[model samples]
Target: MALFGLFRRKPHERQGFELYGAAVRAARHPLFFARYGVADTLDGRFDLIGLQVALLIRRLHRDPDPRGAALAQAVFDAMFADMDFNLREMGVGDMSIAKRVKNMWEAFHGRARAYEAPLEARDEAALAAALARNVWRGAVAEDAPAPRALAALAMATDDALAGQGLDALLRGQVTFPAPRDMP
Candidate 1:
């Protein structure tokens, strides 16, 4: 079996890399930072990426196909690996890097859970509150339109991902609706 490993053709991580790339592109869309008022800072970018990945994971979790779950985990591992590489590029010291990454990991989990229920319920108000707290770092007012607008986009994105086939998603293809079209 070990000898046959050298002949393996496919790069197993290709799909995960592609999917993570799509999520990053979607999270970086200008509308999110411009119209939605999500700051273009590092934290803002991280939160947006987390939200996008969480939605993708949610979609994958619903599929009866075990392949979807495996793909979802692969995407997740790819994200954290990128984070580790980014920290190194920024010159974060080795000791500090692990702590920072751990903090970010915890933050991502909390925010993902915060989004899950509201998105599942299609509860815009709840989702908006969560967005304001996480994306804006609680700097925005509860009644501000920014969070609400972002929440609308999130819901639409969720629905869009849900509609796409798992096979297509595995091919690194996913569609996100136009933010301008959302409420």
Candidate 2:
């Protein structure tokens, strides 16, 4: 019987968070990694994602202009909830890729807001170029659960994004390089 099938209680069936936790458990397989290159490290990626999203949620609650925060939260939620889809989309094979993606997002949010109000023509191309260095893909060795660099980078990104408004960040209108260019 599957591990999930062994659970007699249907707590997860009733609670969305519990269901999500079960999904997280299933995402740990190496076959999962082989099919979806990102999200190889369960704890680190989720922790950083949870932290960042918490901040986004709080910001959305506080912001008078909350559309950006809401959208960012939604995007993050979609990414985290579908571990396989996100990993496959990003072509990530280890934790470092997670970190790189997080850092890139944060850096874009952190420094991309020097443009005109309402973010018209915010020069995303330039901003993306600036953050291009933060991208990482498949840098972890086969034996490693996740790359140390990814953990560090994701933590750093979380710190950066915690204080910011997503709309202001997105309004700044920065473009991210294609995923393949991520280091």
Candidate 3:
């Protein structure tokens, strides 16, 4: 039974991981790191991916379909799994990995909560402040473009996600607007 279970594979899990991968790819878009002034570092990458994942999960949270809830859980699981894998690849010691991952999870959740209200309100200034505080950790350049661009991107991404049908999202067909298209 155990062997069969291992081979059977959970389709939802696979789809969730695929969706997370798509979000990560979107986060890695070069324009953000280059033109938008996001730091080209591990923390910056994680913040971008975390922001994207939060947008998707927020959309799923509002969905009425039960499957949306399941998929949301799956997506969250896949995100943590990816974080664990990333930490391992960075050579974090096994004993410290758990603590590090826990901190990452907390950071992700904190940013998500901070983003929720501004995103829901479509308030660009608030979003910019949140991005500055959380994503940039108050270290953004004095004239950085990222805060404004990222705020616009987050709002645009939220709108895009909202337009996607629950069925389409479940099928791992989510799409985000290009950073260039946001403003």
Query: Which pairs, if any, clash in model 3?
Result: none
Q: How close is candidate 1 to the true structure, as a TM-score?
A: 0.90
* Reference-based TM-score, model 2: 0.28
What's the best-to-worst order under TM-score?
A: 3, 1, 2
Tens-digit lDDT track of model 2 for 16-78: 333233324432334324432444464434533343333333334445665544444544454
The ten-residue window of minimal lDDT in model 1 covers 174-183
lDDT per residue, candidate 1, 1-183, as tens digits? Answer: 999998874433678778888999889989888777888998999999999999988898889999888888878887888999999999999989989999999999999999999998999999999999999989997558888888888898999899999889888788766667234
- Residue-level lDDT of model 3, residues 1-42, one tens digit each, is 788887885558987997898899999999887787678898
TM-score of candidate 3 relative to the true fold? 0.91
Minimum summed lDDT over a 10-residue window in model 3 is located at 140-149
lDDT of 2: 0.38
Assess every candidate by TM-score: 0.90, 0.28, 0.91
Off by over 4 Å in 1: 1-12, 181-183
Clashes of each: 0, 7, 0
lDDT of 1 at 26: 87
Angstrom error of the Cα, residue 81, model 3: value is 0.5
